[model samples]
Target: GYHELRHRRVYDRIWIEYHLIFSDDTSLQTSHDISHRIEDQVDHLFRKDEVIITAHLEPESHEPQFASTRDEHERSPLPSREVGP
Candidate 1:
């Protein structure tokens, strides 16, 4: 079966299939998170000087999205169904 698909180097260091939505705020928001999640995920593939890439995820899909900080970043992993096709 041949069809369009996507590939992304996620912060998790996984080669995930991704769909991109580009925007000014989107980029900014992503960079903001990397500044926070950076420490925890630093040992992964992400380059220390590299910034994060942002996507406009469906609202309420991932909550309490931290633009920065660690203590506040901890909430809960999203339920499987919360992220969908």
Candidate 2:
């Protein structure tokens, strides 16, 4: 069915939500791999232990500052983050 203008917002919201662009395994896999490499270079990079979470889209709670999600496909390959060393 062709899209109608009336349902644009609704459709867009739903499509954005519940979208699993990347599986949990993949996210954790990449996260771990990147972290590993960083740790190899710096002895205690992210060694304090933390839980990383990736939602389908931006968190519905607060504006995303550090974490990223499988939200925007046309933006970047991975869940974009504002993290730094």
**Best-matching candidate per TM-score:** 2
Error of 2 at 48 (Å): 20
Model 1, 1-85: lDDT tens per residue?
0011243554544332222222234455664453334323432333443434332232222332332332443332222222212
lDDT of each: 0.32, 0.32
Instruction: List clashing residue pairs in candidate 1.
Output: none
**Model 1 TM-score on a 0 to 1 scale:** 0.19
RMSD for all candidates, in order, please: 13.5, 15.8
Which candidate number would show the highest lDDT if scored against the true structure?
1
Q: Please give me the total number of clashing residue pairs in predicted model 1.
A: 0
Model 1 residue 40 lDDT score: 31
| Weakest lDDT window of 10 consecutive positions for candidate 1 | 76-85
Residue ranges of candidate 2 with Cα displaced over 4 Å: 1-26, 44-63, 66-85
